[model samples]
Target: MTAIPSAMRVIDVPKPGGPDALTLAERPVPAFGDDDVLIRVAAAGLNRADVLQRRGAYPSPPGAPPNPGLEAAGTVAAAGRNVREFKVGDRVCALLQGGGYSEYVAVNVGQVLPIPGSLDFIEAASLPETYFTVWSNLYEFGRLQRGETLLVHGGSSGIGISAIQLAKALGSTVFTTVGTDDKASFCEQLGATRAINYKTQDFVAEIAALTANKGVNVVLDMVGGSYVARNLQVLATEGRLVMIATQGGAKGEIDVLRIMQQRLVVTGSTLRTRAVEFKREMKQRLLQHVWPLIADGTLRPVVDKVFDLADAPAAHAHMESSTHKGKIILKVGG
Candidate 1:
């Protein structure tokens, strides 16, 4: 095994502000625990959560690195004493509690997975955060099933794209809302039965018409605020509303009568704060179900753009613009 380095380059958010607040700096290599593996990062995935973290609206969980990053693909550089699933020299991608922007990061073994042979490091880097979030919310909490209809908000974003593909692969019909005509078309090509342009149409009304007023069985909503009430209006009886983000606004008004009348379930989750055991179970499920699709080209991550580690600010700027259609990545190390 190669010797661990004492210091590594990392993107630091020195203050709460815009993309330019992200600065390149050097930090000590993170230490690993008994059940952890130290990864030599090849690439890092950018997420909206990172943007929130940068702006100080969202903070890293306790014990997580102060730097902003949630997922990465890399080669295992070292393994903790109790880590049996991976070893030095193995290529992997990981769901991180934090610190993925660095050259190396120590992650719990349970959060790590082997990179598919068919995917390069950049593509593998995009998988963990979006795939895990979609799987856990759409399949588990949302209770989506074959033949059920689903509505996904922000349809061209990383999480939305994953949800669209996975729902379609599982035989659920999908409708998604995007901001532009081009993005709507992009979502349809990714298997959305219909992509509603939220800028030019009322998603609630469009969904009502498309479903003959019967409504969809599930709604994956990232935009909160007024969307909550509208989502309730568009959900079928016994439907589920899974809230992953409140990009629009955190507060939402809902009609208690509506929820009860439709037997609707409103749920949501954040992947970074989940326990290691829980992530282990999620990783197992992905390996059993989704990885094959990724390997065989039945599913592919949409990488809208990539930046060098030093240019993280530009990457974040692009993401905040809300014009990109898929995941943005940072090429960190070889």
Candidate 2:
């Protein structure tokens, strides 16, 4: 093994505030436990969760670092005695609870996966948080199946793009909502059957028209609040509505009678707080099912832009602008 550095630089959230609150600091490299592996991070993926963490709306899980990153890709620096899946020098990407915004992070072995030969560090870094979340919610929880119809909100966002591609690749017809014409075009190019521009059209009406008034089988939602009732209205019988985030707002009103009448199922989840065992199971499923598609070029990660580690604040600002088409990344190391 190469000599590990005693200290490394990390982006820290000094307090709950805006993007400028993110600042750089030096800290000791994290140590791995019996089931953990220490990774020398090359790049980190940015997510809306990180924005919430920076603003104090989302808190890190117990034992996670104060830093706000949720996924990273890099080479393994060391492995704990009990870790057998990965060893030093292996290239891997990880789903992290926190601390990915640093030069090195200690991750549980089960939450890590080998980087596919076709993907570079930045692209691999973009996979874990979005892929895991999309798979867990869209298939595991939402129960999306082949020939089913799915409506995905935020078509140009990382999770949205992942959902669109995965659903299409799995033989489902997908409809999505985007903020602009460019984003709509991007979503269609990525295989969305239709991309509704939310600013110019009502998604519920669009879905109703597109599905010929029969409605869709599942709705993958990130914008909650006002969308809850509308989402409920656009579901077919026994349809599933899976909520991953409440980007619009947390509170919403829904019709219980309508839910009962339509036999609709409303469910949601957050990935970071899930148990290691659950993530391990997800990792296994991805390796068996999704990794092959990624490896063979049937599916690919869409990167809108990348920023240097020291420019994390700019990255956050760009994300908040909501203008980027896909995943935003931070290059942390070579």
RMSD of each: 0.8, 0.7
Per-candidate clashes come to 0, 0
In angstroms, the error of model 2 at 67 is 0.7
TM-scores of the models, in the given order? 0.99, 0.99
lDDT by residue (1-334, candidate 2, tens digit) is 7799999999999888999999999999987899999999999999999999999989898899879899999999999999988889999999999999999999999999999867999999999999899999998999999999999999999999999999999999999999999999999999999999999999989999999999999999999999999999999999999999998899889999999999999999989999999999999989988989999988899999999999999999999999899899999999
Model 1 gets an lDDT of 0.94
> Which residue segments of model 2 deviate by more than 4 Å?
none
Q: Rate the local accuracy (lDDT) of all candidates.
A: 0.94, 0.95
Whole-model lDDT, candidate 2? 0.95
RMSD of 2: 0.7
* Local accuracy of candidate 1 as per-residue lDDT tens digits, 1-334: 7898899999999999999999999999999999999999999999999999999988999999999999999999999999888879998999998899999999999999999757999999999999899999998899889999999999999999999998999899999999999999999999999999988999989999999999999999999998999999999999999999999999999999999887889889888898999999999999998999888888888999999999999999999999998999999997
